[model samples]
Target: MREPYARYLQLLGFDQTPHGVEGLRQLVRRHVIRVPFENISKLLLIRRERRGRPTTLNEYLDGLERHDLGGTCYTSNPFFAELLRELGYDADLLGCDMTRVNVHTAMRVRVDGSAYHVDVGYGGPFYEPLLLTDSPHEMRQGPYRYVLDRARDGRLAMNVFTGEERVHGYLVNEIPREREFFTSIILDSFRPAATFMTQLCVFRYFEDHAVQLQNNVAVHYRAGESGETRISSMKEIREIFENQLRLPRCPVEKAIKTLEQLTGQDFFAMGEGDLYV
Candidate 1:
């Protein structure tokens, strides 16, 4: 294996290279727990460089090693697909639809004799791959439930439910896409109206629980219960990021300061609402 790739495996806590369906599951599980879904690095890059773009594979690996930073779908999913390919898995980078067309990215890997939807960047509680089949696959982690089913249009839909209420979802397109296909869309995400550019959001998922922070609100979901707390200050935000999410303190602080300067408001005073990831 290449040196950086070897280091990446070490960061994921793997002693030997993984293969097959069970190995794929273990890889996915370890990945999502170790890396997080956060926009802090993105925000910092955009602020310093005055532009938006996708992170290169080496840059992504470096960020994880240096700052405990993982990116949004645009960065995390594509690089992860590349890593899977390097490990000899038949992985394809696929596009998906949220409120807009081809706005989100995911992966489809053919492991063993079956195909599976593997998403480690969605900032959700997906600890393993969701098998792609005609039957709906349901998974419950903490207080949230996820169902992956085929829609009438032949597209796969992943729906998230919290206490019988369908809160969020996306439709996956099976066609594979080249990296250049998402360049413009990724650039557009740095626009003033985009969600991440407007607010501060970070998510970390574990096997049994998940933690999320959006602006002034922090929410956590544990075994059978979940709760939300309103953050009152930047100090509180720093505590949550450093202590709970295990993110580096310098980048978190810099991102918070940049967000306040960009939006002209106290970062911790904004109201929390549903963020379309």
Candidate 2:
């Protein structure tokens, strides 16, 4: 049988035929760079018409192919796991306690008798897979260096430092999980009170740079350079999503309206290119 993602690899800008361990790494790199980590469905109030059934794998693929969008941890992990399995890999889904209270999903893969943690939805912290081990290991890509260590609770903690701040870290358990484990949290994320419903966030990671848009602020950081941020107007936000983030234009207005509802700002009243940060 043909792999589900065999055709889409070209869409992600790959021409070489990849196989084995290197193939796994290449697949992850292409995915993280091309498919942004975003929650446009929650922002736009779009829900799958499952009629009380759990979301299916086909639904996740449709979201990516038809909508030109990526999803939160729940959707992204399941989708990625399926792609990996279809391509022939020993892959499983793992849940992490991002805040030690909320669960985040990632992939654990065993390739060539070695275990690795592959996380495409992590946005920036992980641009590549890290060796899955109890001992500390560092992987540096571009300007950021990520450290992976085992926490006292026996979970792998992925940490990264930006300047004086320990900017990002999350704890992932070694145990594998299934989609049913994240069902409730996935539902909660779309609720009105959930942060996903109110905030506007989009992140795109590349080999040397990354762009993040949170609420009305946009930041672009490059290797060996200080990050720069600016307050974005509704128009500017749309432009960034379309041109910079490489997302479809259809969801821009809905996302902007959602941000307006969250911040109570009249973006039209603001001056163009005004400094926000």
Candidate 3:
């Protein structure tokens, strides 16, 4: 188990042995860019289970290769956690509901003593995680930012941002007892959410920025900038296969067709013209 996990670390550029806080930060920056935050495979897993089946790590890895991506916070954090354990770093996945209406999921991780509000899988710009500290602090990266504070009732309130507008992305439960209840929530995430279902999207953190391929658009986050680029359109969605994301045209076509077939709607049926324009 350690060998396979260690291999992933090598792939993620950890020094086989990271020294301390600086090393941990580099690891965070490294994997966010290396492993993709994706949902195609997660959606596939949900579908398979609905039909009374299961998926394996090999199946997931294959999906990672086929989709040209990995996963959102759910996928990226754990993948990062696994590799950290392999590299002997103390890490854990912090599950969050984004405490908002417009989005589905988000997570932050503490690789050593510090925290990072990682949402590379959320299909938009991401907020840097909060480093472990006593005082209040806020950080902004591209289109997203977060302020960390202890609520009166003793919760870690993350005041999230998308420019001047701000909302609660999530309330980090500071009660150690509460965090313990979700001991297995990590692997359980892949099993599917039985109560709610919706279209999935993600953003994988990269070295310089982050990459997001959702519904039909493939984009990359440019640092110090609030907007992202539509590298290819659903029209050029095939490029996700031929280009960087490595999604195969055939299966991707099948996935796209399934969505249209099931929902009775095309991507742009909402009346927006060329999304890239």
Top TM-score prediction, candidate number:
1
Candidate 1 residue 127 Cα shift, in angstroms, is: 0.5
Model 1 CA deviation exceeding 4 Å by range: 141-143
Candidate 1, residues 180-260: lDDT per residue as tens digits? 899999999898767888788888887678888888788888876779878887678778878777774437778878787
- Clashing residue pairs in all predictions, respectively, total 0, 0, 14
Candidate 1 lands at a TM-score of: 0.94
For residues 196-271, could you state the per-residue lDDT of candidate 2 as single tens digits? Answer: 6556667777677777766666667675454545554557766777776677544767666664665466644432
How far residue 187's Cα lies from its native spot in candidate 3, in Å, is 11
Order candidates by lDDT, high to low. Answer: 1, 2, 3
The candidates, ranked best first by TM-score, are 1, 2, 3
Every candidate's CA RMSD:
1.7, 4.5, 5.7
Top candidate on lDDT is: 1
Model 2's TM-score against the true structure: 0.81
Which residue ranges in model 2 land beyond 4 Å of their true spot? 2-17, 46-56, 133-135, 139-145, 163-168, 248-250, 259-277
Error of 3 at 96 (Å): 3.2
Q: Which of the predicted structures, 1 or 2, would earn the higher lDDT when compared with the native?
A: 1
Clash pairs of candidate 1? none
Query: Could you give candidate 3's per-residue lDDT for residues 200-258 as a string of tens digits?
Result: 35455544665555565545556566443343345476665455554453255544444
